[model samples]
Target: MHTLLKNLKVEINDKLYVKDPESSDLGKRILSCSIEMIYELGFEQFTFKKLGLAIKSNESSIYRYFENKHKLLLYLTSWYWSWLEYQLVLQTLTLSVPKDKLNRAVEILTQEVTQDSNFSHIDEVLLNKIIISEYSKSYLTKEVDIENKEGYFAVYKRLVLRLKDMIKEVDPAYAFPASLSSMVIQGALHQHFLKDHFTAITDCNSTTTPTSYFLNLIDQLIISNGKK
Candidate 1:
């Protein structure tokens, strides 16, 4: 697990929030409770009004930080990707070998998320659950193009690029590094999604935990320096 410095706030895009939610007690409450409420109630059923009541703040007060629930979801998912990218960087950097870095990257990306002690206001473990169930809603929308143009996906892209670099370091001549890296990342998550929501669809999960299964696939698919 990545150690979060005390009160280490991950600043998301200003476009995701009207005002920085981490700046005030109420703002922090909104962020903290929103993750909890959304995880409990699902995003479709979660509302600022419910959040306002839960936190004992007025509904209008919640509007000061986010324009709408979709934006809040955007903010949450954005923060998640940023946090994940940070973990990938820290985990991979301490390892010297190129193949080891690639392996560590996939391992961190695929494993079940655990709560970190450093980011006190955010429950990352619950947030990871939200990502598994609700994140696609943030991007699979009519405004996705506009949001993409405004760089809403920057953190996720940065992660893919980091993985792409590690893949290239292992296999300079390999074609489709970006696609391969993204497949591993997204495929791991989707497999988890299937396991939790659609039990009968995925069978390979029967053999091993998804992380171990995917790591083995990585080793099989790409023989770095033809070592495999």
Candidate 2:
């Protein structure tokens, strides 16, 4: 799978960036440094000037790739989801059993991310950390509806729809497949955040991860619904 993915490009929306970061050495450097800087400084504190220094390039050069920090965040989040969608498809595509496929989908969506050597320029693990912590900032804005119309969140919505389809396959009568799908994706991020900072409020820890919680949730919700 890694070999297959090495040649695969996780395409993001063209509107997300001024230039394709994967096209040039400097462009790739911009993405690599931006991910590191955003993970280290937090998005609110991350700046073009800071990323420029990290990559030893001018701030304007960074702008050639991304218009501003918010656009950059949008690009990053979009890339993460596109990559994750690849994983979900590759991992679950072969299962003949509906429930088994759904279970694997839940596990992939909820489990903590690990580094992928196929894409060396971006650290998916750090990107996942950013998603868990700062993903809301990408869309929690007045422009969200406008951006949604522009298809800025297309990859994410597509991912949710994939899970929704999987849920429907398990229980065609399930009325809330869309809700459950989005909840598992969004709830996994929330639970990871809670486990990291608000430990007192969540039961998820190193062993009892969000993956386990959501897996059990699917069993109860979809499986039980099927039995009924």
Candidate 3:
């Protein structure tokens, strides 16, 4: 899978950026440094000025790639989802059993992220941490509807739809496949956040992960519903 993904490019909405960050060294540096800075300082405290200082480049240079920190966050989240969809598809492509495919899909979506050497410029693990911690700020705005029409979240929606289809295949009688699919995706992020900060409220811990919890939940819901 790593070999197949070596040359893969995770496409993002061009409208999210003034310039393609992957096109030049400076632009890539902006993305790489911004990820590190955002993870270190959190999104509210992250700024292009801080990113510029971190990368030792002018603030104006960062602007060439992203109009503002909000757009940069959108770009990063979009990239993460697109990259995830690639892995989900490749990893589950050969599974002939619907249940097996669905299980793999859940694991892929909820599993802990590790750094991918294929994309050296971006740290996927840190990006996943950002998604778990700061993703909501990207869309919890008055302009979300406008941005939705502009397709800022198309990749994420498509990923959910892919899982929804798998759920339907697993249990054609299940009436809430789409709802369950979206919940699993969002719930995984929420559970990860809970485990990291509000540990007392969540069952997930060092011994168990969000992936394990969701796998059990899905099997009970889908399989039990199918039995009826």
Q: In terms of lDDT, which candidate is stronger, 1 or 3?
A: 3
- Residues 17-125 of candidate 2 have per-residue lDDT tens digits of 9999999999999988889889999999999998998898989999999989999999999999999999999998789988889999999999989999899899999
lDDT of 3 at 168: 92
For model 1, the run of ten residues with the poorest summed lDDT: 1-10
User: Which of 1 and 2 is the better model by TM-score?
Assistant: 2
Of candidate 2, the 10-residue stretch with the lowest lDDT total is: 219-228
* RMSD score of candidate 1 (Å): 2.0
lDDT for each candidate structure: 0.86, 0.93, 0.94
Q: What are the models' TM-scores?
A: 0.93, 0.98, 0.97
- Residue-level lDDT tens digits of model 3 in 97-200: 88889999999999999888999999999999999999999999999999999999999999999999999988998888999999999999999999999999
RMSD of each: 2.0, 1.2, 1.3
Minimum summed lDDT over a 10-residue window in model 3 is located at 219-228
Cα lDDT of candidate 3 equals 0.94
Model 2 residue 91 lDDT score: 96
Candidate 3 off by > 4 Å: none
Q: Per-residue alpha-carbon lDDT of model 1 for 1-228, expressed as tens digits?
A: 333455356768888889999889889899999999999999999998999999998999999999999999999999999988878877776799888888899888888899977788899999999998998899999999999999888888788889888888888778889998888877877888988878788754655667887788778767534442
